[model samples]
Target: MSETATVFNQQLAARSAGGSTDAPPPVRHVCVVGGGTAGWMTALMLATTAYGPRLKVTVLESPQVGIIGVGEGSTPWLRGFFDGLGIEESEWMPACNATYKSGITFEGWSTKPGFQRYFHPFASMLDNMTMHQFVDNVHARLEGADVHAHPDRFFVAAALARQGRGPRARPNFPFDIWYGYHFDATLLGQFLAAKALERGVQHLQRHVTQVQLNEQGDIAHLQLDGGEPLAADFFVDCTGFASLLIGKALQTPFVSYAENLFNDAAIAMPTPLGGPIESQTVSTALRHGWAWKIPLSNRHGNGYVYSSAHCSADEAETELRRHLGLLDADVPARHLKMRVGRMENQWSRNCVAVGLSQGFIEPLEATALLFVQRTAAALVEALEQGDLGPAAQQRFNDSMRTRFENTRDYIVAHYKTNSRTDTDYWRANAENMRLSESLQGVLMTWLSRKPLAAGLKAGRFGGGYPIVSWYALLAGMGIFPDPRELQPPTSHQARHRLDAVDDFVARSATNFPDHRELLAAIPPRVGDKTLQLYLW
Candidate 1:
């Protein structure tokens, strides 16, 4: 406490970054809490890094708290995630009961009731200039020219999904053809777990009973259900909404954006497969909420997301059944609770949270798994930089925050852009919806029928529609561009390109056999239909 000592300490702290007297902390061994898609994703990604030898990764999960097996529709970025995991698409696709998804069929969100059917097809199906022409044609239609006829007709995914077809990738179209998938979340977790285990990632099948922190508030160790202590250098909290380590142990604050996003309750169910599920996901808006029908190979994943403040769980469940025209006795249902927001800091101290622990937006656009992929990518990038210092952590956290905000904005844009004024929920949203600042700007440019740059405001975790994508949604939803004409592409010199496009569709119709056939070819695992667990 001497004056000289105090001055020396002050000078030392002032000389360091963040004005701290301590040296930058080093991250090596990472302890991942919970073992669903996110936990294993983090482990798998970290294990692949050269830093894996110096840094050990372990996941603590109780077989009791099972994974939330809901997320079915994903953006195209998932292909990159599978590729990063070195998973062969042919091998894993069938094991997970995945069906190719081109885009989503949006229904009942317009001002006019029966005329509400529209398609927000994938962005990769249009060239930059062609998108502008599409936008111009949309404007021409508003002026009574019938320039577009049906925008969805041009969307390869939309056309294919109408009759249940996948896409045929050809070199001529190149970047203009985009597709994703609808799959079972639990099976995906098992698939990833198997891959992680194969890659030498340790998995502990135990629930964390208590977190023991050092005097510095860093997690020194974790107490298992049976009183055994597990220790690691860094921690990842993927324990769903419980947020066991980050929120409970680290005391990280959650920043809820409920004012901007209203839906908070969902009733999820998997129905026996038999419908118009070709290669697309369907989201239909009901009176009180929205219902999603995601087609996996074996079954259809259906859910109704609604505002708890406006409707009861039973009411939402009933609405979902009514929309899909199903009987409750025929299918059981599971209800899920959610808060629409993100953690104030995704990575706090030495712990990072992914999946529901990091944030949960209602399944409107299905960004949950995308969150897992992006979070894992960011963590891997940070670790690959060699040290998880304060600078690195802050950089990673800020980028994730931006990504979450962008996602929130884009999802909000869907609600705000809707012209629906049917019920209290729709009317209220149409009247008082607030948009994120970035989306406000995007909407402005989008109103002009201009394609948005893919990586526009997203720092790292941004993945959704590309340029052609934004144009598709805007035009599909009846948003038109200014009268100023947009020039078409000059690159297609070969007249056969049009024929090639038709050929692509013709082949995609019969390509890859059927979903069930694909599943039959894969080796049986647990509840796979090939195991004779259920009747076809």
Candidate 2:
């Protein structure tokens, strides 16, 4: 293994070890409200990460509230999250009905011929050569040169998905490939709650009736529905959209993203796993918005995310049913309202907002849990540094604001450059002038055929998406010159393709196993007491 990867692996394996004991932490007791994936994730991270020994973590789960059993998609950061917690894939995958996800395949977003669908794959070691060529072709096509620029041909992840392959490489394979997962979110939350309990985190079940604040306008305590008041030195609000602590108690201002992102609601319906499992999510464009088909090990998760301003609940469900070919199927669909925005301050005096309390940018890119992990990790770093004052809080707030805006810009870009004008929803998105300066720069750079790397700086613009993602997304949507006004490529590889990218990706894919066989071998871990499920 390479020295960097070796060191990274070691650090990730040792991530749960407590911090130095030389100095005392500011807060000794921490209480996390709510108990779904967000709450348990926060509680587990606090109970295991730095200052863990010095901290007393308590999770207050409401007995009256039930968990939303919606399936979820993820980015590769989730791998690091489980790794940091010292949890193995075998322990959680089967327990959560999980499936490996290489990337997302977008379908019917464009009206242009041969551009109706494209695959956006995760970057891997094999893309070192093909990605440069893909970028060159994108630039060449920008100047009206005929070239193959579809990203699916350049990355190995798409090939893996196409061949129904999982991401786990053989022991002899020297390189690591990044991957995500599609799983039952509620089951994962239950598993995480058990893991947190194993690590000395207290779990209490009660309904929070009200959030009480101190004289200084900070959260003082929480009053339970039928129990005594509970107080803690610090608070974490994971109360989904209710925002019990940070929103109600502290009254932090909210910053809306309605202008940038228009989707305000969603309808989720899970159907039985119909056939052999594929390792990619399929996102198809609909009239009002987009629909997602995420394949899990046990079933298929289908949903439509649309704007209520242009479409109603029934209208969205009907469109989704038509898309899924289940117009009259006996499947029940659950409707949900989305608050598409972020809080002005994620952290306010002695309390931090995590998960939905922090804010939501929608589920387009599956960044909901990612931001939750980010907030928890940032809290860990701040507490490890022993800085809990106003200055530290402002720094945390400012940093998170930039991250949210950057991620929002990426999602907004997906809507802005869309070629679909079939409905008023898409037409308005195309004509929408509300854009961040950074987004404007990215679009201008693509238009001018400048190196996208120049526009997307390393850290500032690439919140979770790298420069290659911007290239893939823009090029995937057919945001380039028409093929008719094109010339043959003078590039050497395009002429005489000795050792082609396709061959390389195909060869690399051999190192991985079949998706179905791999998942089938994982004996169900849901019944295992080590990671017990929460019986509601």
- TM-score of model 1 (CA atoms): 0.81
**lDDT per residue (tens digit) for residues 1-536 in model 2:** 22222323443455535434456777889999988998998888787644556789999998887766574899867876876555778889999999999988988887777778888786576666577778777787787777777788888888888888987665567655677899999899989988989989999988888888889887788898876899999999888888878887788998999987999999999888876688899999999999998989889999999999998899899999988889999889999888999999999888899988899997888889888888887887687678888899989999899889989988998888888878999999999899987788788878887777754555434354676788889898888887787777776526534258778878888988889887877532121111211110
Report the Cα RMSD per candidate. 11.1, 5.7
**lDDT minimum window of 10 residues, candidate 1:** 527-536
Among these predicted structures, which one has the highest TM-score?
Answer: 2
Q: Write out the backbone clash pairs for model 2.
A: none
CA-lDDT, candidates in order: 0.68, 0.81
Q: List TM-scores for all candidates, in order.
A: 0.81, 0.92
